[model samples]
Target: MTGPRGRVFRTVSELGIHYRRSPACGVGSRSPRKGPRAGDRLPDLPRGLQARSSGPGWHLLVSGPPELWPDERIALVLRGRDDLVGVHRLGGESPWPDVVQGLVRSDGCLGFVARGADLEGLRAYLERWLPAQHG
Candidate 1:
């Protein structure tokens, strides 16, 4: 895909997950300290989702069965889940995340974010929100 500036962006999608390149870990807060700071290694990334170094920040990627629709907008659902986000803790910090960016692909890339919902629910949710790729 091409960016607004006409810069060609590489698309990463496999299984049932989609990937989008983000500047940093934080989606809303401008303050870097509140989220995954630059150069910080993501702790306990979800099994289905992944983040890799994208130039200065990271490229959040979702992987799953190829049948999964490649919906770039699906990443937006990651907001407001502070429990799953990784931050630089001083001491006595819980390593587990309640919600983080990424999702468990149908192929089993389990992510750190625990939606508390089952896989069937997730599939239904996706079907309701995004259009089918094969249909």
Candidate 2:
């Protein structure tokens, strides 16, 4: 498949290569265990969440308790960002074990993962990857 930049990708996995970052880049570490990681296709979300995950642009999935979710400040920072499709709150039964937050690419690949309430990490990842929308 050819991407918007006219780069030819031989497979669906290759489609997200542009979004992948090395561990040194501070996105997420590639682990030997089986689980979500940067560049890995996002695992199946719950039926309800899957329906909402569809659309253009990136999607933010926040799990864990409400207190751990991104606060108003983060929300304000993300406001008006055209690259962001929407934010969906995942329930405790989410497939991604021990993950508190995840950034899902438009092509259904996991671009970033946060295991803790690392709002700063999320902010940084977005800043480095997605372009900010200017008025």
Candidate 3:
């Protein structure tokens, strides 16, 4: 079936997947949502934590207790990326208990989510999506 924006879907599940994966679809602002997911816009940052203007790049938001923080390797990779604005350590409360890191696109949409400060998963995501040359 033809879905919104002229995209075709084989089933309702496909349509739901598309909706969950398309940040431009404006699903983040809608009601009856479960919680933030990849493709949803990053939720408003807590007070005193300003989001940097990434221009056309991405931003990494890391939250959780210090014991679950990202290590130096991840920091170095993010620091070397031209496509990444920088890593922002989120303070205050977090809505996601499983997610420790989020990758926010320049459009303010979340492109990836990492649980338990999983650096390997984060590295793989960067390699697949951002790539080294684009960094």
Q: What lDDT tens digits, residue by residue, belong to model 1 across residues 3-77?
A: 643332222333223222332212222211232322233333333223322122213332333233233234333
Candidate 2 is scored at a TM of: 0.68
C-alpha lDDT score of every prediction, in listed order: 0.29, 0.63, 0.55
TM-score of each: 0.21, 0.68, 0.60
Better of 2 and 3 by lDDT: 2
Candidate 3 lDDT for residue 97: 51
Quality of model 3 by C-alpha lDDT? 0.55
Give the worst 10-residue stretch by lDDT in candidate 1.
23-32
Off by over 4 Å in 2: 1-34
**Rank by lDDT (best first):** 2, 3, 1
RMSD of 1: 15.5
Candidate 2, number of clashes:
0
Off by over 4 Å in 1: 1-117
